[model samples]
Target: MLLADSPPPELQTLTRGQYDLVEYALAGAGFALLAYALYSWTSRSEVGVRYRPAVMLGLCVGAVAALSYLLLFLRWGAGYDLTDAGYVPTDQARLALSPRYVDWSVTVPLLTAELLAVCSLAGARARKLRASTMTAAFLMILTGHLGAQVVGEGRDTTALVLWGLVSTAFYGYLYVALIGAVRSSIPTIGREAAVSLRNAAIVLLATFGVYPLVYAVPVFVDVTAAWLTAIQLAYSAADVLAKVGFGVLVHKVAKLRTAEDVAAGVDTHPEAVWVSNVEHSRAVLPPAQPPAMATSPTTPTA
Candidate 1:
């Protein structure tokens, strides 16, 4: 049946306009940053010629990841029937209420980007790291997709059983890959501890800080309007946090592109000899300091 045909729920809810305004605004900002990063990377990329496929794959995955979320919203909006007894909420309502679609959409693109990033890293000489990254990316997508599917659809035992198996496997992979990535990416005690601590803190906050205030109160608050509003608000807040985090992550990745260029330049130029030697001894090379210029007496120093 068409979305318009869906039964109306008893709830007199806000219009789509009411719901999506913030999402659209944040998404716009997110896209703008992505565009800038892509442009910057393309312009500065030295090995651009070699990693064209990887880049394209990353973009494609990114698009897919984005589509996943869009699909969720579309499904959520479509699922609800606001006029019906149970609120024959269109799929869109279902999507929003469930959170699966958003999860899948977000995770898929991230996984794709990550896989491509791993490939790029491998291309740049982090062979072990690349392998680990790819494995982790794949598992994240797999489990994330399964979890999303399970949550989005209505109750079905067989479907759950089948998807549950897939989910389990994927989750297992996620654990293994995450461990591997961390182990390979950071070689120092302090750095590893810091990274671990930071991630743990973020997860802790998401669970303890933002979740209860915005989400949990609704169930106990015992007013339908209050509950829905609280839930929606919670989701909106989460979305904002996610976009902000992703924007920062992408920016960091963009910075890495510059680092990669510097690395590539060193490899091709005469200075690589020293850097390469340093990498072998300490497993840490000095930051790729830009070529120090000979300041001539008459040259205007910027």
Candidate 2:
């Protein structure tokens, strides 16, 4: 395993100090984010029931992200060193698994479903879209996780590169389905809500793109204290932006959709008749015109 041995004597003190500093800072930030998400969830009484699930899912995303960071912080704080292979404990503790990948295994699928649920139309189309998006998301994350595991297991670099390409392809498919296919259906919610959903997708795709770059850093640079620090910090920042920031945008879209429903005198109850009948629910708008399919050859290329 790379970095299985101690650092060179000249760098030992600096490495230890930097590790402690970064770990503590990340732990504190994780707790703070978790607290904020819980607070937001507790204060969600005013949100309409029809929109409540999406809001709750957003909070779930935040909570999962916080847990990932906290786990990493704890591992480092316990004297586990970040090696190219994985985390190695300095003492008698067992080897620590990668919390970030575990976090993604849970959160990525939920995130995909949340985004789709928020912008969903009130009919069969919604069901189909949600299922497809969720499946693609799961594939994307699974491939990425498997690739990382292969690399950590000392598999050939060629295997890692092939897996990376496979994962990237899956990710591309998800972007096409989410941003391309879903964008056409957003108008069923409301104009303002549609705008919000589009913006949210853009932000999420942009932030999520950073993960691959951070993951690839170790492949190019030697696994040193500074390299590990950069990986942790970059990933932490991406998590904050993708999960927490995207959650805020989702909340905004839900709020706007709820307001539109209220203005149109449409019941916002989860079991309301209009909730399942897209035609009736969207009656406030002009006679239903089929939304033009908007396909982008590239969409910020998530």
Q: lDDT: which candidate is best?
A: 2
Q: Please list the residue runs of candidate 2 whose C-alpha ends up more than 4 Å from where it truly belongs after superposition.
A: 1-14, 80-97, 151-155, 189-191, 219-223, 268-302
User: Measured by C-alpha RMSD in angstroms, how accurate is candidate 1?
Assistant: 12.3
TM value for model 1: 0.45
Clashes of each: 31, 0
Candidate lDDT (C-alpha), each:
0.40, 0.66
* Reference-based lDDT, residue 31, model 1: 59
In terms of lDDT, model 1 sits at 0.40
Worst 10 residues of 1 by lDDT: 1-10
The C-alpha RMSD of each candidate to the native structure, in angstroms, is 12.3, 14.7
Please write out the lDDT profile of model 1 over residues 114-226, one tens digit for every residue: 42342223444455544544555455445433532344332333443454456455445545544444345444223323353235324422422343243223222333433
Q: Each model's TM-score? A: 0.45, 0.75
